[model samples]
Target: MSGVITGERRSADTHSARSGGGAFVPEATPLDDARAQLAVATGLLGYSDGLHAMLATPRRELTVAVPLRADDGSTMLFTGYRVQHNFSRGPAKGGLRYSPGVNLDEVRALAMWMTWKCALLDVPYGGAKGGVAIDPRLHSKAELERVTRRYTSEILPIIGPERDIPAPDVGTDEQTMAWMMDTYSVNTGYTVPGIVTGKPISLGGSQGRASATSRGVTHIALAALKHRGISASRASAAVQGFGKVGRDTARFLHQAGLRVLGISDQYGAIHNAGGLDIERLCAFVDETGTVMGFPGAEPLDRDLLLELDVDLLVPAAVEGVLHEGNATRVTAPVIVEGANGPTSPAAARIFADRGQLVVPDILANAGGVIVSYFEWVQANQAYWWNAAEVEAKLEERMLSAWQQVVDYATQRTLSLRTAATVLAVERVAEAHRLRGLYP
Candidate 1:
């Protein structure tokens, strides 16, 4: 959705599977942002304290010790978590991330976002997230496979096609989903392709699944440009975190006629005022593993990418990249968050004060889950769709949700983020109210 309300205020606050050991860890910044956003939405809904508490708390959580025998015959223990934030709408759905910083609080926050994302997109799934606190980069393929299998086995009791389905997220990818799917199928004594999304196409993954998020972001970005009476050909953009989402987002933006002037990876960034050739840049990254030295573009600082003078800025890399320190420097008029929790509460407020139209990650990056929903439906029916069919449906669905959020915002005079959050929370709250609590 797209219009605006003059007044509204807020606060801020803001996963997974596989095999476990646990130690208590405090809440992280992203979780705090997630909660703050929730508070704003619930207050707007006029929900009671009891209802707010119920909405804030997770429906279930599992922490496990995942032990892996290394390639050198050494054993390492990692902590993993699977949190289901809510299931009043349907089964839990989210991604499995493998990162050294994974923690329960992060998982909780992500799961909570997934809940709203799914609800906002009208997907028949709640929010869930899983993560293992291990650095995938430090592990060999053999070692990573073992970790994925063991983690899947450890959380097998809580995950299933009809219960909680998993997909790929940060520090993980299609191969990770393949391992997870294989492990789950092995335990069930039968193949279950529906247990996961983002798997290989040969294994029942949806067509266009890999680029769904970027496509969705591009869809929204284009819509935002139109909302501002700007044409894509005249628009310029800078995308940070040139990984899965950022890479494709830049490419699609360029394809859609936007001057993609800046692109970044973990190592560094590159910029060309005339617009970088995304295809060649992708080839360079594919060959060199980073955007650090693309010959067509000049080197730029990674942090400077977000502050570049552009019409659209996509933060697709990791959480907190747009925190309090740099939020004020961001010059992009439109931000379609491609990463979960990329903007902190303080930063979001700054954007609001500056009158920058910030499309929250929940609505901006929901294309992945929406496509995952399609993948799951296709798997259950064993009816795969053609790429053209998938893309058309995706564009239709994304634009529809954007309009809905825009309409809500315009009608209520709320920010796009607040409107999207309020609509999602209201739907979930309605589902819960109808289901009612059992004694």
Candidate 2:
């Protein structure tokens, strides 16, 4: 087992997990962009500068140095962060990610987004996010577990069942949450399931937490398609970022009889004029860690895949994939952002001006947080809901939120993304006003 572990740990030596230049800004980070987004959104919503400025920044940020002893007998240090974007409504909730790209700025923006995502869905939780800057891909399960435990301990001071709860995000999942839940529980001397969301079902994870985001994305896509008068069954769909959100969104859409023409991941892309077999593709992804070499599909350049002519495009991976450069080339009539900030404001404007409908992240990807809320509720109540119950509630909420945004967009003649941002920011602002500022 130890030998198997060391072999897997050697894979990180190839540098596939490089986190795109987060060390460049030492102090104020890319998360500043999330604040900038709030600023822009507040401007759009007609909020005063003083109020927008307050919403732009995180309330608390904890930086911890996580030191781990690797199996190779080498000691390594990782930078970990927990940024709570807001805590007005209830306890903070979000995912903890382990990646080479984890940094204060990214975490801050993500946390801020969480604040709004929670508020938009009316979930009784605020927004928070944490991450450690390290490549988990190069480590074995034991090494990963050690890293997770240590990181959890480092952030232990601020996390709790009634405080800030953490779940799995990028490069983390149920096993990760399981470790988190155990670490917190072990120290507290009792099992406290509410301390985390997205845990293993045996430990109180929700029935559909894993696929909640994708399911929600599918619901948003269906809504967007309908609003635009595009029949989902006849629509050609392309999904970028074929991981948790992308793959599941594709799966749901495919199950709904949509022709998924193209899909891509960090490795590469696969294309089919008719429709690719998402089931086989998902199995291939599970076995190989990507969708690059799936049989019966021809490879296409990752950049070019986005330019493909399709009725719908889902950017389910990273942010800023659709910027000024490719936003104009977007041939899709409906752009459903399954990923956070996948389309920049300028690019979103290009699509909007072109009469394209974009379902923003706050609304489109609210499913994960919604399910996380369910998990949290089940944990606190000491009862778990069945998958059917979870899915039915999820669908009901997604549809209601969709209608709210659609009505607002229609009445104001605004873009869906704009309407969503406005709606989310307004709700948070209203909550803030109801509570009033604490002097």
Residue 61 alpha-carbon offset, candidate 2, angstroms:
0.3
In candidate 2, which residue ranges exceed 4 Å CA deviation?
Answer: 1-33
Q: Quote model 2's TM-score.
A: 0.92
Model 2 residue 113 CA deviation in Å: 1.0
Per-candidate clashes, comma-separated:
34, 1
- Candidate number of the best TM-score: 1
Tens-digit lDDT track of model 1 for 1-439: 1111111111121111111232222223778889999999999889999999999999999998888888887777888889999999999999999877788988999999999999999998999999988877778999889989999999999999999999999889999999999999988999999999999999999999999999999999999989988789999999998888999999999999999999988788899999999999999889999988789799998778889999999999877777666677899999989999888777788899998988989999999998999999999999999999999999999999999999999999999999999999999999998999986
Error of 1 at 234 (Å): 0.8
For candidate 2, the C-alpha RMSD (Å) to the true structure equals 5.0
Compared with the true structure, the alpha-carbon lDDT of candidate 2 equals: 0.83
Q: If scored against the real structure, what TM-score would every candidate get?
A: 0.93, 0.92
lDDT of each: 0.89, 0.83
lDDT, candidate 2, 1-439, per-residue tens: 1221111211221212112341221222335446656776798888887898778878899998877777888777777889888888888999898777666777888898888888888888889999888778877898889889998998898889888999888789899999988999999999999999999999899999999999999998998898889898899899998877998999999998899999998888889998899999999888998889889899998877888899989989876677655667788888888987676666767887888888888899999999999999999899879999999999999989999988998898877766776788888888899999888
Model 2 residue 419 lDDT score: 75
